[model samples]
Target: MKSIDGISFKSLSSDLPAGLVVFLVALPLCLGISLASGAPLVAGVIAGIVGGIVVSLLSGSSLSVSGPAAGLTVIVLNGITKLGSFEAFQLAVVIAGLLQLTLGFLKAGIIGHYFPSSVIKGMLAAIGLTLILKQIPHFLGVDKDFFGEMEFLQFDGRNTFTEMTYAMQHVEKGALIVGIISLLIIILWDNPKLKKYAFFKFVPSALIAVLVALGLNYFFRISTPVLTIGTEHLVQLPAMDSWEKMVNQLSQPDWSAFKNVDVYILALTIAIIASLETLLSVEAVDRMDPLKRVTPTNRELKAQGIGNFISGLLGGLPMTAVIVRSSANINSGAKTKLSAFTHGILLTISVLFLSPFLNLIPLSALAAVLLVVGYKLTKPALYVNQFKLGWEQFIPFIVTIVAILFTDLLIGISIGLAVGVFFILKANYKTPYFFHKEQHHEGEVIRLQLSENVSFLNKASILLTLHHLPDNSEIIVDGSKSTFIDYDVLDAIQNFKINAHERNIRLHLKNIPEVISTNAH
Candidate 1:
């Protein structure tokens, strides 16, 4: 074991095993995301390597892992088609990186802070559901659509439910068997007794399951040829011979597309979305850290920006800090960022030397791994807990999930945010001021105390209260505790003041600036 910069060499054993686990988890995902994004398979692998190596080295987060996020699959696909070619889209990725760098320098990473807790939780749950739904087809060997594509409506015109129907009709017995066995292995590995053993602790369940599935499929191919998993149901990495061939495989960005206005727009969009996903993932990962380590958000943004820049130059997809990979890294017993870097190195080595072996792993096994991941994210407990938090919290959470399931991630979150804001406004209107009424010898005495920092959202409530004052009542509009009040609210009060004489009410204002009547002005 060795130690460097607070990362102990003693933990190398732990880190190495964890890295291998993350590498296994990332392999199919990179290929799937790339296929979904309409980019070449090599592009996804390149982004995965860059994210694990470059971004991890530069990020302040100890456990957060970076990769080609599934969240960006839809955006990347559209961007590529709209921009005409993959090479042109790569230029947009470069510009997006530069824009992300600018945002980091400007400290815009704080944008994550404004998202409601409900909305964030909702996003997580939505993604989990998406994973489970999207992977079902792959698990059954229905390869009509790209694997790992999470959008509700797929590009091939098949939605989530429709894909399940298709999968049912086109079920491959070999894949179904592998997927079921792999899922069983994963479930069994989670047993506390099994996990206590050194071999089980060091070796990841997913890796073991995959290897077992591979052996089973290989045996079936020889013994029961008809039951063998076909090429469409397995991983398909581009095999390389020498370093020169690998270098030749790298794609270059089309600089000539730089002048197109649409390219810049796509760049800005990618930068914004990628930055948001990174910040959200970073926040979520920090919360998951057992040590409760806090990550520097701005620094993370800058790291991702630099990563995307390098990836684009080398013909890779856009990169972001992904919650799935990061959570897998932590759960696999990673101690530091070294695990992430190790994963990258493993990915590179696997691509260079073990591509043929990787190609033999069945997609069903990978889908089983993702199914477990998705189940963890959208566990029943999460919904129960959210429901207990009251409607104000639960509504947005549920709404976000449904919207994301029906529409898309960004749109779903937007809808959830809008609903959350409506609740906030309602609460503000209900509690902006306290109205106390007392009966007096002369008339009813009404005392209204304004809350601090009252805003225009309270205007309607204030107007209604003022209008319903009993005839010949004494009303006091007090702003002594308020540091600031919106002009709309103030104007409503002034109008009430002007009408007091006609309504047979006595009006008095305290510590509130008088608003001149329009006729007087």
Candidate 2:
């Protein structure tokens, strides 16, 4: 009762409904992420299967969902291009999975806790913005480059801004209609009146939106031949009639790529970033769970490693515990890992029987799905909240967003990390001690109240105050509340005390001990 108390988690109807919701949310994401990364569309579905089936079975998490991440879109795009081939990138993914396994064994999952919240948020916001900007062209049915292409200079000879102009000029009418209709359906389904219905509860809006998009395209083909969407503006799943045909369609990893030097570097990058994203996603899911469950971070790493290894071997993109689908799972009231497993089964079914229908779904509809995802990530509220937190949080958050937009993810994050650290040191410098002044029986009294732990950073502030003490003033340097005082700080106090007679200041110590300064010796 406590788990469900004040919580809206659904009852024991099996995880089927919850799993279906997750599947609905995941399907479009798989295709969208694949499009963004420029990887084969089937590869995203493969990663989804491995994430749902393999990860759920191996992981200790009850609510987390794993799949190809939008956060890794930029990395995949660059890795595929730099490694010379998709097969080579797949090799890098395999190595990255192995690295994750090693990290799990070494208990390096703790590294996830060290990333600054501001920087991580900035990264997510950056990815979300990138998704919207890239998807705009697709939403207008102008598919020139893939979805995750955020680089300023594009391969099509148009920069990021120029691409937008080009997209507006060459918009496809039929795809735009499908996209607008799908988006309207998704938005309208979220109305409180519609959500009260049991049917709406059982089926997710995203699924309904996609289905409507598919039907509209079919209608166009039959009744409005002039507005019919072409193959280039829709999903391309390389239709397969049988298991044998599908087997031939599966791309194999090139084992020869093991010799490439860039493979190892790319692997390291993916391993670290994927591990952080997984840890963070699971942590978030746990907070959302009314039962107050905690996922084992190290175990999650190993499970994800195994999943990625298999996905890469099968020519899938790198995967992680994705927040969007996982949040949908918990909200759908899934009580067990069966929800995740069931979703994987559904994905498998789609791959086997529904590839042609999936191919019929317009790209604009998928773009609409991702547009919502992007909006969630960069909601205007996030900006307002961060700014309210003041300069320390705002500056790094903005720096990370702009840097990632102009540069790439890795470099932008590194730069933001540096800024976050600098602000941390700056805050610490001002918090070393509390200074107070009051009139005493003897005369004007100045007190330096040491913090819980006074370190070397406090020495300069203390010495500067000591130097400015007025003549005939009574000064107190207290450390009664301090557990530890650095030797440098104590030495500064002693040196200040030694010169007190020249300024006619009376120096007193409450709990501080004398430490001879090296200057005196």
Candidate 3:
């Protein structure tokens, strides 16, 4: 039951069903992201296949999934226009993959460790809220917007807040019925009593909801033609009827554009941004892992590099480790990489032979699925827990969620990180050295114990403590635990030594280095 790579086949039962759920979630997202990025519709599916198959094979993460992401859509949109053609942009993508591989070798993925836990949780919560807000249009039967976008601002000039009201006013009758029923099915399937049945165990609630939605719409078509939810709001995939036709759609890169300096610049920009997004997604996914396994990040960069490289060669968009699909996989009971691999296989089969059946499923049904996923990620309990953790953790977490709501993911995380660092510095400033008074036979002795590393930031606190010391008291300055002391702090202690003579204060230095202080005449 165990593979040579140590993955257990015993979990296939759970992984296979989880894979079906992910395929359902990823199918529309792949198409929607392509539509948003201005790439060929097939291109997104190609990237998803590569991310699920090739990246899953090479990555150390057991559950994380990768694919064409909305985060990189703007970059691709501008990259294509700047380069003058999609072929030239494809060449840039290949170079970006090489750059990411270099980053893996250089161990640049260690940057993921620096982000605070509060910021990571905030990022997850923001994505959840964005998912709920963004799906409202689709749930109401409006399919004007693209998918996989977490940003508040929409490409169609509507913001996330306003889109809900617009969708409510323009709701489609048939699509609304399917969506409401699908939501109910998913909610009911999640009930503990229903889960006790073997049928619910083998058939995921998401897949069941999609199937029921398809059936409902079909019945409406046959029984009452007036209320039929037609093809307009259904899943749309570019036609690929023949093998020759599919082969023609796979684009080739323009190697002739290699000499241009802008090509290299674009490659570098994509490499840096994609790598950062991948790292952040991997970290968040790791936090959600039920077994609490740590993924090797550098290895993940290499896997993503390979996925992007393959995608570029076949005329696909850039990719990063995506959080939504990964979270869906986890919530569906996935235990290993087999689930992602299975989804890749399913995508290949479905696209090749079942496009007609797929095109029948309504967007409203898929939106309901995402609605539940979003609720779990941004649950009310998360806010209550963060609030209980107090201001230092709560402030950064709240700031990250609010900032991401208005700006974008990367910018919001940066703002939260700045706040987290500020708190670290403030804590260091206040408690750089521990000051205590001890009763002694030879009058009261005051001991100042410097922390392990006393930097320039700690100098102000040390100086204030030295200045406020009672006149003519015995003081012991301890540096035994310090590995390094800043010259500024050492000088303050040395200068204070000068004033000790006037006050007749007995100064005892323990492992404190002597620093010459210039006498101010």
Candidate 4:
């Protein structure tokens, strides 16, 4: 029940500028994700538009943008292959949307709350690191493929690392010169003092870099060995001259596959993985929100569902609330959902009217921008900061990072979570007994104080003492300071109660609270 009316026109104006910034950032992503998802590039742009517009209108988030995500690339790839046609894949996307909508209705927005803070931070840091590692090739001007594919060994037979090595081996001076110039401009523009220069302050640095790079590549004809990202990396618009051609590209769901068990399994798989990714992104984005706003998890699911549904219908890839775009929105200083909506509008309009122009943007420039972004995410400062927190936190954080670097996202997170749990358990093992006061023996009565949290681990000590108690002795089991008692030790005490009665040993249980129901007394 949040209303957009409360956000003022002045605020909207402020947000518009930020929206424009986000739009520029999202432009390449829309195409990049589409390229990653193996869907038509136009479909990716369409999803971006829908996510920006439709999801923005329905969303509870103030600044998050909905779009096809790099994370969903695997799902989309598998979906299309299984469905047999792009049209059929579109149907699945729609179905995924409906599922997300249902999740929102269930008030599942609380899903973002449960992730451990350490793991979440690690995720963002990992993504940042990954971005930096992946963009090096692009920055080097060797763009043989579009962005978003996670495989290190790309179809080109080079992984991210190999590509970097290859680029270094046969460097293109023209692409290199343009890239250096673009990087320099961005680095200089980021300066606090120089940033305030009104003439250059508000302009998008990435766009500038791209224009400069393109001009250098086109007119100067500097023959550097570096490769340039071409139209294949950019989004291509659907030939909309005839409605029939558009329909031909649209995918439909396979009703025949509906009866297959794999369909249900795939649906569930999509639901779970998509939900986990969405929840994780939502958590990360909220952390970036300057206003300290929180989103409802269920509402997010619904918005995602709606986004997926529409994207599928149009032959686009499925979407979630992506962190890269969300972070871009936050970084751009967006004030409300209007920012997301405006970006969507820009996406739609740009694809329709600016297709040719957008196509001219060099992939290297986009890679340069991403290079900066990735550096920020995985900056050495992040590691230093986490290390200062203590070894307990730092160890898991580093483990997660290394795991992500060597393996994939899910595996790395899993390992980090495991290590974190191990640390907790190890800490617990150091303290086995509590409430310590030595046993006291008066003329006739022996008094023993019970320890706090007398767990099974401590049972051996207490039980051994009980068995050695002198015959005909009067004993008092004092638990006056005990806060909690474990069940295994309780069983031992109850047995002591029985044995004491038979031994003609008078035993008194102090702190005479009736034995608390089923637990240790």
Candidate 5:
């Protein structure tokens, strides 16, 4: 096969194996996200295909993978419930896509850059913890609810810890055995010696774990009826014959719902949350890239917009740049965006020809793979590294983890952001300006340097300094360091200049722009 774009055939070789791994990872996640969001199972699969093929084709990112995000699950579920139907929710997805497209054109993607590194790290850890907590039930065959609900309070009224308690009481022996074996296989496959072997290099640990789990389950079915896995403990894709039947399964949007005010509000909410999640995931993926290639954030937004648009048109859930799938792609040794495209192709092929085989794979195996993913995200080293950065960073990081674990993604992020802002404001309040005094032949010489960004919060301090300036002193007000000076501060400085002349204080201004006097006089 020829290379895509400028990527080499050698790269495609690596991408092919990585694509298989990602396809394996994306399958269960797509279904689970759809289940949690109250959308049709087919909707999530369509989104995975669109995100991989369409978004990967349009995206400037080489490694980031786009698909249904767990972060949007709550919003989607609530939207569907409020809109009264899946069709109406699909309409909202379309509107959200259009809104994201507008945001891309407006260059709103830069907003991602403003998020503190601590907060981003916290978000990553929070997702990791959420994954571990949510998957525990599935790992034990406690299929009471969907597999990918990240919220602490589930739709079924069971909290995260409570669900674990329930799962403990009703654990399936067969599923637990499969899950433990799969997790052990995954861990063993990560051995350095195994990685060095040519045969093992071509095989992804997750793929091996899944195959072994499937084999073990089958063996149990034939040999020990009592130990056989139940249907609910395994995947359950809808059986279909012919391409026509697959297409017939697709649901259409309710165009009449466009005029509803609540629909528009839901659309806006999805647009903002999806875009934010996409941007954050893009940032995180870029950091994880081995080559450290930077993704064009605005381009990513545009690509996600188109992906969501196409997915919504085909009765699919909303799409975003999902970190989980992207991380799997990167860790599996993917080389180019072609890996994502290949995964999309594989997803379609599996649905058409391999559904029965896929259905045979136990959910516990997938849960084991995700557990590994979660551990990687929340490794002890990361926590220790954050702690070493001092309390300024550590406080927000810990708070984000706690908040997300107790609440939802958006609320947790909002809390972390508020805390980060408090730190910034505190620092700003203390060091709004630099003042240095020197004794000279002509009385005291004072040099005042304004901070880079001086807002109204710094106005009082600046005013106080000006008021206390000794008479018959030479003072220099330097704005050279400042990029922005709030009008309130500038007005105060101007008033001081007038008073300085009358008080025999010589005041000099540097790099400070003249503003029109706002005084009525």
Candidate 6:
């Protein structure tokens, strides 16, 4: 048996370098996701820490990093409003975490297995596209809103297109100049000539670009021409007068909310959504793994559950196995869960030690990094490859992209799934069904022979055949001609047997037990 279920730390040193890389990438995302979610900035950091330390210890993934997910921003934002208080919402997060823990115990991770491959591909591509599109405004020094808002038009009445235009019109010369320079440095760092340079080879391109940009800002002392990330977008820590004060920042859920039916519904919603995102990410990360590491989904759920519970206790946002952070980890050459743990530790240390220094990091520089990240995701090759797979795949894939851009992530995916299911049914309907008439009586016996594979989509056609069969007719189902019969179809056939027996008709099934007698009539 192939074992795909254990973690080993044979090369802990390698993980540290990768972990530092992931930590740098995660810091901005943690803060930005928190801002997008309308939660306290520290909340995002807390979730990142919990995801890193707790989830990493428990999760099945070797390279995947969990944290406050951009996908859950809308849910958190709306949840706070609906729940009447942030503390109240924290309670919901706790419940949701426990629910996920229960789901893990139930081995419900199988749900991830059933998602159609095409849909998963479509989703990943769409996410990549969205990430690229959303990051462009930031790269150009347009800071009207935080990252990953679903609305093409933002709360400030500026659409993505408008933001680009606005940035061009009121271009901060300093910011634009620095951003363009940073972009050039990043591009150069990846160049064949510069890649071999000993100093540049191991150093991250983003870190170099950021350092150069920051140096320019300091040298010129230029306050104008560049849009700096203001206090509004920066991570904020709770006023820690003492240890007790810091703990006071954490909130306990009101047990009273449990009495309300909506609370349970919310809990289920979080569990389902969080589980889906985590499982999908696991699949994606596995596909990206150079070593072909397969993560256990049930263990992943438990990891995420623990992360979320700790997040809730500390007044942090809910956690999920986010693709963005996970991808960053993979691309950065992370080898083990140690990378995740270290990233969390970095998040903790930064807030505690180097927060003031972090404040110096230009939003435009971060934007430049994300812009590259986004481009990698939504590259032109993805579209071309998806299209080559044929219209059935292409249509849903394109629809998913459009729906995500126009509506939101969840809605767009639902729309894509519906269309995909329709196509499956249509294809099933076209499958030939053979009918054979009896040799003796007039329209008394008929035999139905199915194709190689019978799916649930064929249920309606089979049901219709059974419904309209003549009152005294005999029916025989032949699976010898079919390689595989769906469980639903088998159940339908068994149910028909009872009906046929009651009506004095014969129901015969071939290639199945006890369906026929050895003696001829």
The parts of candidate 5 lying over 4 Å away from their true place are: 1-8, 430-433, 451-474, 480-484, 496-507, 517-521
Going through the candidates in the order shown, the clash numbers are 3, 1, 0, 22, 0, 2
The residue pairs found clashing in candidate 1 are: 1-9, 2-9, 3-9
Per-residue lDDT tens digits for candidate 4, residues 1-521, read: 34453244556644676677677767777776776667777788778888898888877777677787776676777876776666666655666677767777777767667656677788778888777777676666666666655454566767767777886775555566677888887777767787677655566566577778778666643553234334554334444444464457555555556555555555656666676777888787778777778877777788778777777667677777777777666765677888888889888777556666766666666667767766766678878898898887888888877777666676777787787766655544444433233444644666777766556666676777777787777877777767876666667777687668677777788873454334334
| Cα lDDT, model 2, residue 46 | 91
Best of the candidates, TM-score: 3
Worst 10 residues of 5 by lDDT: 1-10
Model 5, span 1-521: residue lDDT tens: 57665345678667888888889889888988998888889888999999988999999888888889888897888989999999999898998899999999999999998888888889889888988888899999876787666789887888999999999999998999999999999888988889888778887888899899989999999998777888877887776546987899898999999789998898889889999989888888877788888888998888888888889889999989988888778878888898899899988887777889999998899999888888888899999999998998999999988998999877898899899887776666778899999888867899999999999988878888888888878999999999999998898898888778778999999998988768523
Q: Model 4: how far is 63 from its true place, Å?
A: 3.0
TM-score to true structure, per model: 0.91, 0.81, 0.94, 0.80, 0.92, 0.82
Candidate 5 root-mean-square deviation in Å: 2.6
Q: Mind giving the per-residue lDDT tens digits that candidate 1 earns over 71-186?
A: 89888989999999999999999999999999999999898877888888888888889888888888887756766576778777888999899889989999999999999998
- For residues 339-364, write the lDDT of model 2, one tens digit per residue: 88889988888888887877777778
Candidate achieving higher lDDT, 1 or 3: 3
For candidate 3, give the lDDT: 0.88
Best by lDDT: 3
Backbone clash pairs in model 5 (N, Cα, C under 3 Å; residues 3+ apart or in different chains), count: 0
Lowest summed-lDDT stretch of 10 residues in model 4?
429-438
Pitting candidate 1 against candidate 4, the one with the higher TM-score is 1
Q: Which pairs of residues have clashing backbones in candidate 6?
A: 172-225, 175-226
- Model 3 clash pairs? none
Give Cα-based local distance difference scores for all models: 0.87, 0.81, 0.88, 0.69, 0.87, 0.73
lDDT string, candidate 6, 145-197, tens digits: 86545456576788766777776776555566667888788778868787667
Better of 1 and 4 by lDDT: 1
Pitting candidate 4 against candidate 5, the one with the higher TM-score is 5
